[model samples]
Target chain A: MLGIDDPLIWGVYILCILSMILCVVYGLINWNRGEEAEVQEIAEEEAWEEEEEKMQSEELGL
Target chain B: MDLMILNLVILVYLLATLYLGYRGWKATKDSEGYMVAGRKTHPYIMAMSYGATFISTSAIVGFGGTAAKFGMGLLWLTFLNIFVGIFIAFVIYGKATRKMGHNLNAMTFPELLGRRFESRFIQVASGLVIFLGMPLYASVVLIGAARFLETTLAINFDLALLVYSVIIAAYVIWGGLRGVMYTDAMQGTIMFLGMAVLLFETYSRLGGVTLAHQALTNMAPLVPADLAAMGHTGWTSMPVLGSPWWWTLVSTIVLGVGIGVLAMPQLVVRFMTVKSNRELNRGVLVGGIFILMMTGVAFAVGALSNVFFLNTRGMIATAVESNVDSIIPVYINATMPEWFIYVFMLTLLAAAMSTSSSQFHTQGTAIGRDIYETLTGQKGGRSILLTRIGVSTAVIMAVILGYYLPGNVIARGTAVFFGLCAAAFLPMYTLGLFWRRTTRAGASAGLIGGTLVTVFMYLFVHKAESAPLGIAKMVLGRDVLITQMPWPVVDPMLIALPISLVLTVLVSLITRPPPERHLDLCFRGMKKG
Candidate 1:
C-alpha cells in the first residue's frame, strides 16, 4: 500500500470524489434545460423542413 | 453453489434492455427516425449513449487487463478521454458536425462527408471501409465481455459470446438508433455505478488509496527482468521516457484512442441525435463524469489489484495467468463478493452490448444508406430495410470473428481500429468541418492515403501479428517489408497521420475549388459559410 502520510494521495482522492459529485449535481440541475432546448430545436427543424418543401414545390412550378 | 440469484439478476437486466429496445422500436416512425432518432434525442440520453458507445468492455475489461500489466500510467488515457473525447469532441467538433449534418440532412458520418464534398465515391468508399473494418472492433468487444462471463458463470466462452451477440443485434436491428441510444443510456448508468463500487471496494480492500498505490510503487524491483529492461519504472509511474514501454503507452494506446475518438463513425452519429447545440452542451458534463468513472476506476482498480494479490496470495500481479486479459476476471472473482460479481457481470455486458450495438448500427447504415443508396441513387423506406439487413450481416460477421480471435487480443484489436480511424479519417473529418477550401479530391486523397499508409504499415512493418497470419514471412521471407525505421516499430498512426494530413493539404491546394453553393450549404453556420 502507498504511504498514508503523503497528503497528495488524500488530495487526489478528494479531487476525484468532488469531481464526481459536481458532475452528478450539475447534470441533475441542467437535465431539464435540454428538454426545453429540444422542443425549440424541433420547432425550428419543422419550420426549416416546411420551407424546404415550399422551395422544392416552387422549383417544380407546382 | 446455487446461482439462482445471479440468473435472476441477468434475466431482469436482459428484460430491461429488451423492453427499452421495444420502446425505441415503437417510437421510431420512419427511416429518418430510425436512422438518427429523428434528430430529437434527449440530451442526457445522447450524452450517455455517446459515452457508452465510446467505451466498451474493451475499455473496461481489455484495458483494465492492460493496466494490470502497465500500471497507473494508463490513467493518461482517462485524462485524454475527458479532455479530447468529451470536451473537444462535444464542444468543438460536435457543434460543427451537428450544424453541418443538419444543413446537409446527412444521416451517417460517411454520408455527411460525402455530401460535404459532393462525392458519392467518398460516401461509398467510406461505407465499404467501415463495413470491412468495424467488425474487428465489434468482435473485440464481444470477446472481452465473453471472457468475463466465461469466468463468472463458468460457461463456455463461445456460448457466452453467441448469447451476447444475439441480444445486442435484436434491439439494434429492431429499434435502430433510438433503441441503441435508449439501451445505451441505461447501460451507461449501470457501467458508472459498477465502476464506482469497484473503485471503492478495491481501495478499501487494499487498505486505502495511499497504501494501495505505495504498495504498487514499492514493488518496482519485483518487475520481471524483461519488463525492467523495457524501462518499466513501477506500476505507479510512467515507464522510462523514450523506452519501448513509454512509446507503446503514449503513442499506441493514449494518442491512438484519444485522437481517434474524433473520427469514430458510431460516436460521431450521437452528436446528430441531439436536438440542438444546447443539448450537446448539456451532454458534456455527463459524458465527462461517465468516462471518468468508467475508465478512471477501471485503470485504478486494475493497478490496485496488484496490492490485493500481493498482500493476500504473496504473488506478483501478472502471475494471475498466462493471458493478460484474464487479469480483471481473476481479480474480480477472487476478491469481489458473489453478489457484486453478478453486478459487475451486468456492467461488462452493458459495456460490450452498448458498443457492439452502435458498431452494428453504424456499419449497417454505412452499407445501406451510404454505399448502396449512394451508388444506386436509392432513398427512403427501402434503405431502412436494407440497413436492418446490413445490421444483421454485420452481427453475423462479428460473431464469426469473435469465435476466432486469440486470447488477450482485445486491447490490441481495439487500438488497431482506433489508430486506423485517426490515421485514415481524422484529417479529412476536421478539415471538412472547418475548412471551406477542402475539396472533394483533397478529402478523398486524405481518406485513401491515410488508410493505405496505416494498412501498409500494419501489414508489413508495425507488428508481426498484424500481418495476415505469417503470410509476409512466407512470401517475403521476413516479418516486415522494411525492417529499419528510426524507431524500430513506431505506432502506425504516428507515421500515417502526418502523411495523410500532408496529402490532404497538398491535393486541396492544387485542385479546383468546389462550387460556391456547395461550400455555402456545407459551411452554412461557420465563418466560411
Candidate 2:
C-alpha cells in the first residue's frame, strides 16, 4: 500500500488519517451536546467571579 | 529573496501580532483573564493555541530532519500525536481538567493539583520543578528561532535574540495567555497553510505520493554503511526490529514525545481555557486537523526530501548536509520558489513564537501562582504583578541561556523536558483526576519519586543524555552507567512512568483517601455531558 513494503509503516500512515477523521466525526457529533450543562456552569462561573473579585479587593485593601 | 520584501512581510506580520496582543490586553480585567483567558475563550482559539504551542519550530525543523534520516517510521509518532495527543486528551482529560479547574477555581496546572489534594507542598513542588526545568527547553527554542532570523535576515545573533525575546515578552507580559492564544491562532493558521503547500508541492514535484515513495524505496541500497549497522532498513520501512535504532526510534522519539505531551504544563492549561466540554469537543476537530497538517506534512515531506535531493543533486538529503537538522531547510531552499520561502519563514517564526509564548506564560505562572502565592499566601493583584515580573525574568533567563548554551543542546532539550514531565506529572495527574482513592501522600510520592528516577536515568542510564551530561563518566568512569545495549538506548519515561503509576496506586492504597467532600466538589459536573 502506498508504495511501502512494510505493513507497520502503511498501517501507521492509514491510522493517522483515520484518527484525524475520528476526531472530526467526534467533534461534529458532540458539538452541541453539552449546552444545558454550560448554562449552569455559566451561573457558577459568575458566582465564582464575584467571589474572586471580592477576595482580591480584600487582599489588596481596596 | 529580496531583503526589502522580506523586511516588509515580517513587519506586517509583527504588526498584526501586536494588534492581537493589544486586543487581548484590552480584554483582560483580572488575573483569570490573564491566566486562562477568563475561561471564556472561543473553541477555535483554544484549539489552535494548543496545537500551535504543541508543534514548535524544533518539531518541524529538528524532528523533520530526524524523519529524513529515520524514514517513514516517524509517521507512528504522528498517529500517536493525533490519537493520543488530541483525541484521548480532549475527550478524556480535557473535560475532567476543565470541570475540576473550575470547581477549584484553579488558575494554573500546579494549582489544580494542589487544590485538589489540599496540598500546598504539591503545588509549590510542581511549580519549582517547572520553573527550574523549563528554562533549558525555552532557551533552545529561543536559539532555534534566533538562528533562523540571524541567517535569513542577516542580523546579528545577539540583536535577533534580544529583539525576538522582547517582542514575545511584551505581549505575554501585558496580555498574558489571552495574548499568547490570540497570536497562536494566527500563527497556527500560517503554519497549517505553509505545511499544506509544502506537502502539495513535494507530492506534485515528485510525481505524486506513491511514485515519490517508490523512488525513495528504490534508493534503499544507498543507506550509508554506518546507519545500516545501526538498523537502517530503508526509507519506507521501520528500522530492523529490536535494533538500537528501533529502540531509539520507538522508545525515545515515538513514545517519549507522543505520550509525554499529555503532561506538558503549557499544553494542559489550555484545557481550562474553554468554558465547557462542548468547546473541547469542538476543539478536537480543529486541533486534530491542525496537528495532522503540521507534523504529518513535515514528516512526509522530510522523508520524501530524499527523493527530491536524489533527483536533483544525485545524492540523499543527509549527503547534501551531514547535519540532519539542515535537511528540511535545505530542501525548502532548493525546491520551493522565492515567494514560498517568505511564507515558510513566517511559518517557522509562528511556530517558534507560539511555543515560546506558552512556555513563558507557564513559567511565569509557575513562579507567581504556584510558588510565591502558595508560600507567601498572597493572591489577587499582587500575584498578577508578580506573574508579569516572573515572565520578564523567564525571558531574560532564556535569552542568557540562548547566548551561553552550546548549539548541540537544542537537539536534546525537547525530549528531556517532555520525558521529565511525563514521568513526574502524568501518573499523579491521571490518578488525581479519576481516582477518588488518590491521597495527597500518594500524589506527592509519585511526583518526587518519578522526578528523581527520571533525573537519575538521564544522569546515568540513558546514553543520549548521560554521555553528553558526563556525570556518569566523571563519577562512574563510564559513558553510561549501564553499557548494556538496549538498556542504555531506552528512554527514561518508559522506565519511570510505570513505576510512578504503581507507586501512586500502592501508596494511595496504604494511605488515607482524600476527603469525600472535596472529592465530590472536584468531580461535580464531571460526569455530565
Candidate 3:
C-alpha cells in the first residue's frame, strides 16, 4: 500500500476540507438573506399574475 | 457465494431509482413544475443533487480505473472540480446566471440563452442539440454501471440497461428536477459514506494508510519501456518532460472537464432553482465539501488501487491492464472481502443512476420544453403534455442505445458526449451571458459549425483506436498536427471552442443589429415586469 499519510496528499486533503467548511459558512449566510430577496423579487416580477389574482378576487367579491 | 446477495442489492437499488421517479411523477405539475420543481427546491436537497449529478459513475468507474492505471495524477481533477467546478461555478456562474434568470423570468438553459439574447431560434436550437446529444451521455453512464454489474453480478447486458434506464427515468420524469434533487441528496450521502468506508477498508487492507503510498511510490519506475518510447509516463512519476502523457493529463482531462463544467447545461439550470445569490453561496460550500470527499477519496483510493494491484499481482501498474476502465471494478472485486462488495456495488449504482437520471432530464426538458413550444404555440393544446412525451421518447432512446453499445466503446462515447456539449453549448452559453451583439444567426452558426466539426473529427478523425487520418492529422498532413505542448489535447474542444467563439462574434457583428427595443426588452426585463 502507498503512504496515505504523505504530507503532500494529506496537505491537499486538509486544504479541501477547510475550503468546504468555508464554502458552507458562506452558503448559510446567503440562505438567510436570499429568502427575503426572493419574496420581494417574486412579487415584483409576478405583478401581472398578482393583478390577475386581484381581478379574480373582485369578480368573486371575496 | 454472496454474489446472489450482491445481485439482490443491485436489484433493490435499481428499484429505488424507479420508485423515486414514480413518486416524483405524482408531484410533477405543469411544465414549470415538471422542469424546475416549481422553483421551490430545498437548499440541502439542491446541493446533494448537484453533487450527485456532478460525480457520475464515469468519475467512479472510468476515472477511478484511470487512477489505478495513471497513479495519483487523476486526483487533480477532483481538486479542480471543487475549486473550479463547485466554488467558481457557484460564485462566478451561479450568481450571475441566477441574477439574470430572475431578471428575465427564465426557466431552462435554452430559455435563459434565448431570452437573454432575444433569439428564440438560438434557444430552440440549443434545446434540440441538448435533447439529441445528452442521451448518448446517459447511455454511456448506463453502459459503465452495466459493465460493472456484469463483472460483479454476472447479469446480462440487456437486463442491466433496462433496469438502469427505468429507475433513473422514473425519478427524473416524475418529480422533474425536484425528484432528482431529492434522490440526489440521499444518493450523495450514500456515495460519501461508501467512499469513506472503501478508503478506510482499502487502507486497513494495505497494512495501514501510511504504508500504502510507500508501496505505490516505491514502484513508479515500473513504467513500460514501450510506453516510455511513445512518451507514455508511468505512475511512479509525473511523466517524462515534454511527454504525451503530460499533455493528455493537462489538456484533455484537466481542461476538458475543468473549463467544460462552465458549459454543462444540467449544472447551469441548477443556478436558477435557488432563490438568490445567498442560496447559490450556500450551495457553494456544500457542493465543495461533497466534491472534495467524493473526488478526493476516489482519487486517493484509485492511486491506492495500484497498491492493491501490485500486492495482488506481481505486475507493474500499467502492465497489469491495458484498459484503465476495468481497473476500478477489477480491484473492487478482487481485493474487498466478499460481504462489503454489495456496498461498493450500491455506490457504483448510485453514481450511475444519479448521472443517468440527470442526463435523461436534461435531454427531455430540452426536447419537450424548448422544441415543442417553439415549433408549435406554447399554449396550444397539450404543449406541456407534449414535453412529457419528449421525456418518454428520450428514455426509450437511451434504452435502445444502451443495449446496442459495446461495453468497450462506452468510455470513448463519454468523451464524445462532453465534446459535443462543449462544441454545441459552451460557445453560445458564454456569448449569451456576455456578448450583447450576439445575434441568433451567430449563435446558430457557431453551434452548427462547432458541433459538426467536433462530431466529424471524432468519427472520421479521432483515432483513439487507430490512425484513421484524424482531422488534425489530415490538416497538418504529418505525424504531428497541432502541437499543444504540456497539454496532451486530443479533444477538438481546443480547436472547436476558439472557432465557435470567433464565428459567434463575427457573425453577430456582421448581421444587422436585432431590433434595439427587442434587445433592450430582454436585457432590461430583468426583475421588471
Candidate 4:
C-alpha cells in the first residue's frame, strides 16, 4: 500500500489489459461463427426488400 | 549550414510527390476509386496512412511543446488515441462503418449517413457542414507546416505556406484521395523511423533517459520564475491544481481530442476504405501499435526537450515566448546531431504534408459532395469534374487565407482546424452512428445549430478581448466576455455534440419513425454468412 505507485493506477492497467484480451478472444471465437446479433432477421421482410430492389432496378434500368 | 541545400532537398521531395500523384491520376476515374481507392487499400498502407494523417505536425510540434512545458502528463492522450481512437475505432466503429458503407454503396461520410437514414436532406446538410468547416481545419494544418518551415529554413513564412499548400494541392488534384493515402503511407513510415531514431539520439544526447529524468527532477526548483508563478512546474512535473495549464491539459488535450477523434470526417471516411471487418480488425492492431509509437515517442521527446533547453539556453523555451508551442522545433534543431537536421526536416515535412493532403482532399469532396452537389445536382460526370474543381478551389482558398493569417500561426491554425471539426462535424456524426432515433429534423437542427453556435462562440466569445462581447459575454460571464474566460468557451464540439444528441433523440422520438425498412437494411441487412 505504501509502495512507489498508486494501486488505482495498477488496477486500471490490469482491468484495461484484461478487457483487451477478452475482446480479442471474443473476436477470434466469433470469427467463424454464423450471423451477427446486431442484425435483425426477417425471412418475409427479405422477399419484400428483394421485390422492391427488383422494381427499382427495372425502373432505373442498370 | 546552407539553407538553400535544405530548400532544394525539400523541392525534390515535392517533385517526387507530384510525379507519384500524377501517376495515381490514372487510377482515379469513378467516385469510388477517387474517394476510397476502390475499397482495396491494403491493411498495412491504410494503417500507416491513418496513423500518419492522425499524428500531424501540430501533435508533434504543439503537443511536444506542451510536453516540454507540462512533462509526461500529456502521455495519457496518446494512450487514449491508441485504445479508444485506434482500437475501438477499428473494431467497433470501423467494422460497423465498413459493413454499412458496402450495404449503402456510399463513398463519403455524408453519403453514408444519408443512405442509412434514407434521406438526401441529411446528406446535403452534412455535406454543407463539411464544406463550410473543413477549410478552417485545413488552414490550421497549413499554418502548422508553414511555422515549421519558417523557423527551420529561415524564410518568409508566407512563402513556406504557399509552397506547402501547392504541393498538397497537386498531389490531391492528380491522385485524389488515393494519392493522399499513398503519401500518407510513406510519411507514416518516415514518422515511425524518425521518432524511433529521435528517441535514441535524444537519449544519447542527454547521457541517458534516466539521467535526463533525474536532471529534470533535481531542476524542478530551478523552474523559470514566470513559469513557476504561472504554475508551470517542469517537464517531469504537472501544473498546480486550478491553473491555466491544468485546465488546458485536462479539458483541451484530454477531453477535446479524446472525444473529438470519433467525429472527424477525414478519419470517419477512412473506415469506408477497407474491404471488410477482417481488414479492419487486422488494421486496427497496426494502427494502435503505430499510434502507440508515434504519440509515445513525441511526448517522450517533448518531455526531454526541457532538459535539452536548460542544457543549452539555461532557460525554458516557453520562458522566451510565453507560447510553449515553439519548444519542439527549437529543441530538435539545437540538440540533434548536425547531420540529423535534414532527416528531422524530412520527418516534419512528411508529418505536415500527409495531414495537409488529407485535409485538402476531404475539404474538396465536402465542396463537391455537399455544396455543389446540392445546388447543382450530381448529374453524373459533371458531378465528378465539379468535385475535382472544388478540390482545387478549396486548396487555393486555404493557401490564400494561410498567407495572410496572423497571430501564433501554428496554435491558431490547430485551434481553427480541430475546433471547426469539433463544432461542425462531431455532434451529428456521433448521433448519426449511435443514436438510432436520430431524425432528419433533429439532424439538420443539430448540424446548423452546432456549427453556428460553435463558430459564433469561437469568433465572438473566445475573441471578445480583441472583438466585441458577442452575447456569450453578457450571458455567460464578464471573464468570458473579455476573452478572459480562463478557458475556451466554445470548442464547438462539446456544445454542438450535446445539442445535436439531445435534439436528435427528442426529434426522433416525436417524429414518425424512419421507414423501418431502411433501419433493417442499415443495421442488420448484411447477412454475409
* Ranking 1 against 2 by lDDT, winner: 2
Q: Estimated TM-score per prediction? A: 0.88, 0.92, 0.81, 0.80
Candidates 1 and 2, the one with greater DockQ:
2
| lDDT by residue for model 1 (B249-352), tens | 88888888878889999888767655666676678778878888988888888878888888888877788665777789888899878877897788788777
User: Model 4 misses residue B503 by how many Å?
Assistant: 2.1
Please provide, for model 4 over B460-490, each residue's C-alpha lDDT reduced to its tens digit, 9 standing for 90 to 100: 5554222443455455654354445454533
Give the best candidate by lDDT: 2
True contacts kept of each: 0.18, 0.67, 0.43, 0.00
| C-alpha positional error of residue A5 in candidate 3 after TM-score superposition, expressed in Å | 14
Task: Name the regions of candidate 1 deviating beyond 4 angstroms.
Answer: A1-62, B15-42, B380-386, B464-468, B485-488
**DockQ winner, 2 or 4:** 2
Residues B1-529 of candidate 2 have per-residue lDDT tens digits of 5877777777888899889866655665544533245555678887888888888877888788778999889999999899999999999998888788888888679999899899999999999889888988898788777766665666787898888888767655544444356777888888888888899999999998888888888889999999999999998999999888899889888998899889999888877656667788999999889889988888999999999989989998888867665677777877777767776777687788778878987888798789989999977677777776777888889889888876535546777888889988999999899888999999999999899999999999998888878999999999888787888989898999998898999999999877888888989977622
Q: List the residue pairs that clash in candidate 4.
A: B71-B235, B137-B417, B140-B413
Ranking by lDDT: 2, 1, 3, 4
Question: Candidate 1's error at B423, in angstroms?
Answer: 1.4
- What DockQ results do all the predictions give, each relative to the true complex? 0.15, 0.48, 0.25, 0.07
Estimate, for each residue in B1-529, the C-alpha lDDT of model 3 and write its tens digit.
4767767876877688668655555554433423244345566667888888788878777767666656666666776788778887888777667767766767678888877766678778888878887777777777778767766776776776677667667656544444355556768887887777788888888888667767776765676677666554545345544566655555556566667777788778777656556567667867877887787777778778877777778775445756666667777788777656776777778777667766766776677567777667564345555656776787788778877765444445565667677777787776666566778888888888888777665544444522443554566664333334532336667677788888888998898766767656555534322
* CAPRI category for model 3: acceptable
